[model samples]
Target: MENKIHFQYLIDGDDFTRAGEASSDIKSKLKMMNINPDAVRRVAIAMYEGEINMIIHADGGTIDVDVYPDKLTMVLKDTGPGIPDIDKAMEEGYSTAPDNIVSLGFGAGMGLPNMKRASDEMEISSVVGQGTTVTMTVLF
Candidate 1:
């Protein structure tokens, strides 16, 4: 069997203080495993973006990470309002975040863009009034 390490995290959407905690933990683990710094950085950035999106858009969600010898995979899922237009959402600086969220120094509309840039591969799937799921991978 292929060697792999897996982790799952439950994001608390209502708690801004806990935001990025999951990503931070994963970063540390990757570093400890002697993963390349570039790959670790990419994973951290992508995963952090996903976490913030879940907190800002979805009420709460789950993140799953799988670490393999050659790459890292991250999946984020939330049952909040789904993206109405994936194309528009993919555009930089286009955000549906409310004023209050923007006031908190988030919702700058860079989350998805940044996540995509950081990961080697990224995919998004959503259902209106249901939720959104994002999968990202970074090659080591």
Candidate 2:
């Protein structure tokens, strides 16, 4: 594609049923565009992890994706009670989700770790009481 394509999605917090919609949609779109399958899979996984985090932690959030010929970029922004410790949050099996969330089969503390693993490049920014934004990119 010569021009960049953009998409925006609104995530509803605590809504497990629709948590993966955005990622699914993006996957389909990428496939339709004949993008690389591996890149699409990586983007889907990273985006899905971010969406789940927005639902379990932040009340809700917005995700913006930009598709380019050689790369895909995803921006997940949430207004939740921002992460207290970035280093700790990045650790595998480290999660702050409550017991109730755990029972639902989520909040396994693998969200961020998985996201990082799937994306080629990732960056996170947060303010203690305000919110957080995670930006991830996958190169094709």
Query: Which sections of candidate 2 miss by over 4 Å?
Result: none
Instruction: Residues 4-37, candidate 1: write the lDDT tens digits.
Output: 8899999999998789999999999999999999
Give lDDT for model 2.
0.94
Candidate 1 to truth, TM: 0.97
| Candidate 1 local lDDT, residue 130 | 98
What range of 10 consecutive residues in model 2 has the weakest lDDT sum? 99-108
Q: Each prediction's Cα lDDT score? A: 0.93, 0.94
Assess candidate 2 and give its TM-score to the true structure.
Answer: 0.96
TM-score against truth, every candidate: 0.97, 0.96
Clash counts for all predictions: 0, 0
Candidate 1 local lDDT, residue 9: 96
Q: Model 1's lDDT to the true fold? A: 0.93
- All models, RMSD in angstroms: 0.9, 1.4
